[model samples]
Target chain A: MQDLVKKMATELDLKGEVCPYTFVKTKLKLEELESGEELVVTFDHAPAVENVPRSLKNEGHKIMGIEQKGDHLWKVRIRKA
Target chain B: MKLGILLTTSPENENTNTVIAISTAARKAGHEVSIFLMYDGVYNVNKKDFAELVDKGVNIAVCALNVEQRKVGRVEGILFGSQYDHACIAADVDRFISFG
Candidate 1:
């Protein structure tokens, strides 16, 4: 069952950020991870939830899940593909 | 990755210069670039730098209504689109920037 539990290799908190920069900073962090590693990013900006996931998926990353952490705050888990 | 830039300021504004610089860098890196011009930014459609950028294969679209409203006098060479195209560009691009 240990392999069933996915572990996160990196975490990014992008609060109070806007488009392009949010995606830019997230992409940069993802670049530093090894293949098959997972990154969880926290975003306060509403649009980033849609934009970042779409952008990351376009770059061949897999979106594991998206969950709301608090009011207007969301977390996205991505796996390098 | 596709990068979309919304330019809504006039040619003399510093935003136009930033758009040119960012688009040039993105293009050189073999990345797709799209720029949507509206409001006063439609004035750049007639400028040399923006025209040269269009020649370099950068997708540049100008708002038709703004051009007519401002009497910028646009020719048929470039894409004369509307704000709908701007929204489409923003939705389609991987990253978006607004220079107003």
Candidate 2:
């Protein structure tokens, strides 16, 4: 079998939150990432979908993917670029 | 020459003012700008009240999925789509800036 590569994952759970706070918490967590590292953020706000990825993209980070879990929950994958 | 702006919050909230400020500033800088709205941001373009920004050449785009989620149809000048609408703007623009 081929070797399996697992990237380091950091999850920031900010369920039941709002804007700016979600952005701020995610940013602080992202600050700890090295280039190429991955962060998985979970939040319940739809705005977080736009705000978090947009904020990260503006800061020169890469958005790997965004996944919506349930009615109010989402998972955003961001890579430090 | 082109600037991609994303507003992810509602204007009813004070937080939305930041997005407007940035868009206003970009216009003052003389760049062609368009704003894509998603989530609560779809509400920002629910009326013609922001006509000044439109007059300034800021095209408004709202996420289609978000519009349905929020049940806000019949809003003028706000198109419905996914983040791709916004991403395309970012792809073609000289710069992408987002405010929430």
Candidate 3:
């Protein structure tokens, strides 16, 4: 069996960006996409892994997935809503 | 939704970051945002990051009284308005967030 990969409409690498900014940049990118489009954002800030998803969800966006890619890095898949 | 952000503190305060963060997020969410800067918050009009907010299309207005008190002349990108403008912002927006 094989897991299906979700296609991302856009991607952001915020590896060195901090909290709020991690979410801030993600929010900005989401605005540039059409509704229902997907965005993949990678960041190393631990708090953002939690904060970004919460904030985005609050704004009515959908969180497709969150994966830990390394000791300090994580990736979030979001579908604009 | 239309959003109103009232900022009363200067950039020295941590809430300034909150102001920037929230306004940026609100703008990106396709909401119209108006930020009313009063008291020491007027000082933030010159900060580098604050300029980004203006560029992001957040309507920024500084209190005319505070601008005069601080001896700040007209700033290019910021609007100098009276308390009436602030009242209008409060009345117009569907949601308001305050950072002091």
Candidate 4:
């Protein structure tokens, strides 16, 4: 039903890094999110499979979606409770 | 609710670990987890070794079309035949998320 598609508008940005580090930083921010809150994380790394979403879930956060715009830029959305 | 995690990258890529991290976390939080592997991600299942977290029951749903295109052997457990579709994925979960 795409119910989670409803955008809630929260933003978090992680810069100047690569794998594991980008994910590590993103996890730190998710700790502060409340249920149904949305977070937008901007990252420069090319491989997102291992870090971003994983770290979010590790902290009990929900990753709404991820969009890659051009090369070297990605915007990941997360919802935390 | 159940969740669908899309993995479209290869194991060699840095993103593979991120996908694993997210899937493991989802399972730990008590959410049903399934992964759809596409593009380079089809190779993830081909790997013989995985992290320790994989031992703990992770649901993996692979993209059949992608698998056939790559002509990889159909592995058991971690990989599933394309008989399952995205409609199945969306219907089977509370959330459908992608990682590329």
DockQ of each: 0.02, 0.04, 0.01, 0.02
Instruction: Give every prediction's interface RMSD.
Output: 9.3, 7.0, 14.2, 12.1
1 versus 2: better DockQ goes to = 2
C-alpha positional error of residue A16 in candidate 3 after TM-score superposition, expressed in Å: 53
Predicted structure 4, TM vs. truth:
0.48
Rank all candidate structures by their lDDT, best first, as comma-separated numbers: 3, 1, 2, 4
The DockQ leader among the candidates is 2
At residue A50, what lDDT does model 2 achieve? Answer: 71
Docking class of 1: incorrect
lDDT at B94 for candidate 2? 93
Q: After superposition, how far is residue B100 of candidate 1 from its true place, in Å?
A: 0.7
Q: Candidate 3, after superposition: displacement of residue A70 in Å?
A: 70
| Model 4 lDDT, residue B71, Cα | 77
> Would candidate 4 be rated incorrect, acceptable, medium or high by CAPRI criteria?
incorrect
Candidate 2 overall Cα lDDT vs. reference? 0.74
lDDT of 1 by residue, A1-81 (tens): 424435534788898876656777888898888888888899887656866787677678999899999998999988988
Query: Per-residue lDDT for B13-100 in model 4, tens only?
Result: 8777887777778778887777777778888887754334346567665655466567766676654433233445766788888778
How many clashes in each structure? 0, 3, 0, 12
What TM-score, computed on C-alpha atoms, does each candidate reach? 0.54, 0.53, 0.54, 0.48
Q: Which whole-number lDDT from 0 to 100 does residue B56 have in model 1?
A: 71
Q: For candidate 1, what's the RMSD?
A: 11.2
